[model samples]
Target: MPNRLALKRKSAYLAQLGRCYYCGLPMWQDDLDSFSRAHNIKPSQAKPLKCTAEHLEARQDGGLDTAQNIVAACWSCNQRRHKRKKAPAPDAYLDLVQQRVRKGRWHCAPLLTAFGALFAGHDSGGEATS
Candidate 1:
């Protein structure tokens, strides 16, 4: 599951990338605007997508909602990677995360983390972890 703000921020980041990270093709940020954020690894080539259903590694393991875990990828690149089972290397994932946050979206990441954690019952403002 993803939080609304996180999704919005990701959409914003994808809007900024201008091209898919995987396929290197143009994608649309807003229907009228043409752009893309390609997946670094196609899920079909990578197996992680089998469980997560997304091309992004971080997202495959609950990392997508975490701004520090997502990357700016295009639709085709993302789609090409479907139903495989391994995440990108740590350095690679980190690189993409850094790339996406280059525009100062780091601040938004923490907010998304807190909101997601709270909603998922991981952290409840010190209420207690179940």
Candidate 2:
């Protein structure tokens, strides 16, 4: 049987439709090799591109480890978020992400651009922000 954390992660991933909550980047389930090669990192060290269970209210702040409090996030966003002295509330963070997206500050533009070729004609209106 899968562990609770693994189960939660899976649930969050599906709930978010495999997209990074912060950046809207598609977290491809089967792109480990491509992600590793692109970053020139070993698979073991490529967690940034992997989906992680992120706490809306960080555990250190007395957040419960419950489904309602968790969301799927990319490793990069998770790491960057934790670096801040205070974790922002989920709504605030999401607002910031939307603002960034509208300002053409997408964090994973290159990857999306590459994937764009294969997924031609399915634009997500990302370019309008630029």
Candidate 3:
């Protein structure tokens, strides 16, 4: 049987439609290996841009390991939260994430634009530039 953490994470991921609960970014299920499990108060070893399990309240602060306290988040967002000296209330942190998402501040967009520009002038055929 799967552990409770795994079960909760899976449930949250499915319930949220694979979206990062904080930033509202899409977490692709096709690339499951790239996702991470992040805690509100603890940093995850997993790399960024992956789906992570975020705790609405830190376990150290007497938070329960129930589904209500868990959410799906991207690794980057989760890491940012972990850096906080004092974790903000879940509601406040969520509001901040929503604000950032609305502002289009997530990392993926700019990287995509840059890659597009870099390849825009290149031909698929093997041709050497003068």
Q: Identify the leading candidate in terms of TM-score.
A: 2
Instruction: For candidate 1, write residues 2-76 as lDDT tens digits.
Output: 766447545544543433333222234343211111333332322211211122444545554544445455443
Question: CA lDDT, every prediction?
Answer: 0.37, 0.67, 0.61
Across 1-130, the per-residue lDDT of candidate 3 in tens digits comes to 9789878977888887665676655554334444432221112232354767788887888888899988877778788887899888877877886665555565455433432332233221112225
User: What residue runs in model 3 are displaced by over 4 Å at the alpha carbon?
Assistant: 29-47, 111-130
Q: Per-prediction RMSD in angstroms?
A: 15.1, 5.4, 12.4
* Model 2 lDDT tens row, 108-127: 55554544342333222122
Off by over 4 Å in 2: 29-31, 34-47, 115-130
Alpha-carbon shift of residue 23 in model 1 (angstroms): 3.0
Clashing pairs in 2: none
Between prediction 2 and prediction 3, the one with superior TM-score is 2
Reference-based TM-score, model 1: 0.36
Please list the residue runs of candidate 1 whose C-alpha ends up more than 4 Å from where it truly belongs after superposition: 1-16, 32-55, 60-64, 85-130
Best by lDDT: 2
Residue 120 in candidate 2 has what lDDT?
34
TM-score of each: 0.36, 0.71, 0.67
